[model samples]
Target: MAEAPSWFGEVERAAWDRFRAEIPWLTEADRVLVEVASTLRARLATDPAMSVNAIAQLRMCLSAMGATPADRSRVDIPQNDDDPLTCYFN
Candidate 1:
């Protein structure tokens, strides 16, 4: 796997901060969801041309974390405009 871009960590940190602010009752599960999102964000940043998984583990994890559709919309990972998976993840 390629190393994350020079600004990738900053992006991830910003996303995590946003997520923390949006979620009202934080849990261990929430932390896990953020971590999964961070990883996926890094992967996509490293390879924007990567194929999109129809039923991605990230989506499943979000669901398992009890994230609502509104939460999904609010707590987003940083995404490239060119990545097809961007809409799905966010």
Candidate 2:
């Protein structure tokens, strides 16, 4: 895996951590989306010149990952929390 961009500061780090914590089902495939979302979030916070398209893309990415409340129900969380191997069975 690549290191996070040098521009990633407290805000980006916090967003990354929050995403990982909130979206426990994320796997290697989701890494790129997570990184993009984090970057977009930081840009939105710090860049007054950020484009509307970037903001929309960030919202779409968040919704796709079920990171937003409205999209939470779309995520199918595994019920077998006690067994790490349950993923294989499911």
Highest TM-score: which candidate? 2
In candidate 1, where is summed lDDT lowest over 10 consecutive residues? 1-10
Q: Write the per-residue lDDT of candidate 1 for residues 2-27, one digit (tens) a residue.
A: 22234547767654555456544455
TM-score of 1: 0.46
**Model 1 lDDT vs. the true structure?**
0.56
Displacement of residue 41 (Cα, Å) in model 1 is: 3.8
Give each model's whole-structure lDDT.
0.56, 0.81
Which parts of model 1 have CA positions greater than 4 angstroms off?
1-8, 42-47, 70-90
The lDDT, on a scale of 0 to 1, for candidate 2 is 0.81
Clashing pairs in 2: none
